[model samples]
Target: MPHSLSWGARSIFKNRYEFKVRICYLVGEGRDLNFWTDPWHPDGPVDSQTSIGTMLSNIPRNVSVHDIRSDSDWKEVLNSGPYGELTQIVHSGLFTKELPSYPLVPWYSSLWFPGHLPRHCPVVWQAIQSRLSTKDRLFFLGSQRDSTCSLCRSEPETHHHLFLACSYSSWVWRFILLRFGYRRKPNNGLQKEEEWLRKTFKGKGQIARAIRIAFSATVSHLWKERNRRVFEEKSTHKQQTLKDILDIIKFKTLYLKLQDIPSEKNIRISNILGLPCFSKEKSSRHCTWDPPPEDMAKLNSDASLANDQGSIGGLIRGSTSNIMVMFSWNKAPETISELELEAILEGVKLARSMDIRKLWIETDSMNALQIITGKCNCPWRKKVTLKLLQDLLTSFEMWKVSHQWREANQPADYLSKHDCPLKGIKILPTTA
Candidate 1:
């Protein structure tokens, strides 16, 4: 009840109804129970129904439950009290089944997804819970001179009006929506907008993270701007506020490394924010095919996946770039990285079978390459494959693995895309 309580403590206090339902007192001699304040009854706290005059005269406020019983049965003790309604209730049972429990809120995951901004979380959480001290709430509590939004100076400063209905906030939201490539306009109210965001950005991918960052940043900045206008008598242009939001997003996303081969949307956003989509230090633009040393044979492999079905393809070429073997195999749906690792495994197996002493491997997937080279963690499901592949590479006198741009791995890319045979096709392997 103290005004100086922290937000975390305040949140716990606010959910007292949910917490209160799970607690029920079983009176064992009632030595420790307060007669009035304690919820020893099956119903609830006894003091809730008692009048102030009745409480003052009947018993001391600090009286314990055991003091009234005094070694007597509960029925006799209850029969002497007012109206004796506690007799049947005590006889039946003291179960929490009668207490009303609160259901879990659905928006919790959206509010606290992975990689969320810590400082921005509280503001967004307050907004979602309608706990922010907006001007309307202040006015209702008799502490505000005006309830109009400071940014727009037109609409009442309620959560719905400030977040969605206000002209300034709406423009900021629309601009962010466009930046995220959302064609639909924001919803009519704060709750609807929150529900829309939860339903739309429901994943742990880059785009989802970006969307959440934008939402949290916008809410925090908007509240900040509102406070500035009210307390500091200063204002920032809505465009500048939006730019600040983008800057926060850009800063936060720097820690989020992209997937080995990012999606088109992730690439677009990364480019917009100037994030490095590839894990490699070098850019893929300058990557080109290079023939290995005269003593080494190079294996280039690639995988293509569509609708969870995929194929792996590769070609082992001699030091002179002469193809020694070309292979493509259709496969059941699996992760793209697994398929890429499979392609490398098949290519290496082919080279080993041909008695190549020194070998070089190239693939377009940085993830698979990293896993094979021990540069990153291998997914648990693909550990066996990677372990076998690593063991097989030990057969070669000398071997190296490297990432190549899809542009340079054209032969393997073409075979992966077009040369995949059907499930029952008994196709023969091609060799030079």
Candidate 2:
């Protein structure tokens, strides 16, 4: 809203609400997010979902997510009116489900994949939609006097000619394809070129990614060059433009985790871009459960989510590998990592109640392990629970946490997927 703000900035500010509804916020530390108006919850804004009139009346409208983190904080609000409903949603978890998805479009992956350059998308998307303000489109609308192509003045400047068929753009496209080791000529029209791209780059491999990036970059630069000639009356040699496209592809490839595909063409492209291809080892190593030390008890925990409901399970085994105790509990809808952490927390509590002092914890969720070991940032909603878990770990005489592959953690995984009551923890007998 500043006077110095550009028109585009002001326009974005004006439509901020439209953007807000479409996006979800992670209530990390709750410092920045507004509790009432923000779509931090999966269901949408808190103000729109429930009646918070009498209960939240005394609370400030501008209360932040951080303000309601504690039980004591919510206690006052929950006592009065419909605010109690909000607590049920809050304690469950905050995760974004995809807003209603659109029908699968063939060009979606080509335009918007991991590591795609953002600046190239808008231009390429316009080209794909045949909506670019090329000379033909402007002439048809009576806004431009000439329908001639800006890049190659001899041809009509339609989407097909401007993007693909024109001599200038065709040369740039051919150069890019040649550099990527494709010796064939490009299809003439935009429609045919799109079909070819769809059939060719419909893969998750490194070469497909590179080709897609190069295609978009090529289209974007060609359009920019056309605009420069039409408006600014400036021109760059097609070789320089081709070099710019190559540089763009190489720069994008730098951030990608390229894999060694062991193909001659892939190698040639890799060598051209200076991309390092890693040979991932595919070992057929066996995995099995290992018993704990004579004095230590090992706990394996797992979680499952289905139909918007979550369940957690854990197994505690003594040094002899005998199941000391096993538990299955249904919980409010939560992410797998949160459920795994909860299962570990509950298992530790169970062990503590049994007077077990030495404990070893194992879970299949590396994310939970990272958060527990301070290797990653803990979500705002998990801070208090994690603090309690840390306190519990300190109470043990000797404790350790480690990650186990899902294959080796099948017992806990089974317990998590086991049918159990919706309310309380189901403690199963060791024999059963």
Candidate 3:
């Protein structure tokens, strides 16, 4: 009755398909329906076990038939039912069809697919539709009289003319070709350039990636250059635009290479950020003092002032003694706190040059000492100065920074006043 209605019906249909089948039964006024007859024999009907020989004949080879009354009970039939093997076969076929052909993906697609493609593909499709529907011959051409190419006045404004066909574009293309050692002439049509790109990158791995990155960056830059000239009333430079493309290519290539090596992440990030390559030059513009020595006996000094242009003072002393180098100056700040910072930097430079190891530095500028020790807020001008101080700390064997009263740093203070006029160097008299 009703084509052997029961949970077994689920084996013949699922979800919406099962719902539609149930609707068909209602539409047929609950009449007995035979699905396994000639018309529907391919799909077959639910099994009945009235005759053992008939049931055995109805079951397909290598299949087992079972009865399931509920969704949960279907598991038992699914695991060992007449259709279990068929289900497995269907699943395997579906999976095989869905598997991606990883190797066949294009070079540019591989490079930009992860992030850019998820966003760009839909956008490109939309643009293609809009461009096709527009009345203008050139996809982006405007109707205004002034909307003509600056170099080729005969053509409407378009991406192809501004980047490939126009005189300015030819000059830029030639510059890029010469710089990169390519001898080909600029393609006059955008389609030709696309074809050239496809041919040029044909089986080359590294070259293809470079070309794709260069092409995309060039497209973006050319559009920007065009807008700048039209809207901002600016002139575009062919060499500069070509240089931008080359720079982008070099940067992306290096970045992708770095991404492949997990251990070089930090180094690559530093390079991207324009950090100085690590070295042992022993002197940099940022350091305020030289590193200490292995002997545990050295002198260090730092000068600082409340007002950079007001007065600068510093003291240099041996790690274990009272006497060393000291100086102070009254030069006014060029900006805000430049004079005070320069004084401290000069003291550090002296220590570095003298090869001072294990030096004790004293400064009357509490704020400067706090910044050096990382115990206080740093003024904006002191950012570079603070970084240099940190770099210097890594170079020395031992170093100490201390705060002292301005009265206690009299000798260096006197030396600064005396040196201000003559701009002369003076050695501190030994108090011992």
Question: Model 3: per-residue lDDT, tens digit, 293-375?
Answer: 44544333333334333454455555344445665555554532354456666676667766765555666667667677777
| Clashes per model (N, Cα, C within 3 A) | 0, 0, 10
Please give the ranking of all candidate structures by lDDT, highest first, separated by commas: 2, 1, 3
Which is the better candidate, 2 or 3, if ranked by TM-score? Answer: 2
lDDT of each: 0.78, 0.81, 0.49
Clashing pairs in 2: none
The whole-model C-alpha lDDT of candidate 1 against the native structure comes to: 0.78
Candidate 1 Cα outliers beyond 4 Å, as residue runs: 1-119, 133-158, 171-187, 191-218, 221-298, 304-310, 318-324, 332-337, 348-407, 418-432
Off by over 4 Å in 2: 1-6, 13-101, 277-432
Candidate 3 TM-score versus the reference? 0.31
lDDT of 1 by residue, 42-150 (tens): 6566677655326335577898777765434443545554635552334433322244568988877766777787898888888988899999889998999789899
lDDT string for model 2 (243-273, tens) is 8888887787776775545677777777876
In model 3, the runs with Cα more than 4 Å from the true position are 1-143, 150-154, 258-432
Q: Give the TM-score (vs. native) of candidate 1.
A: 0.47
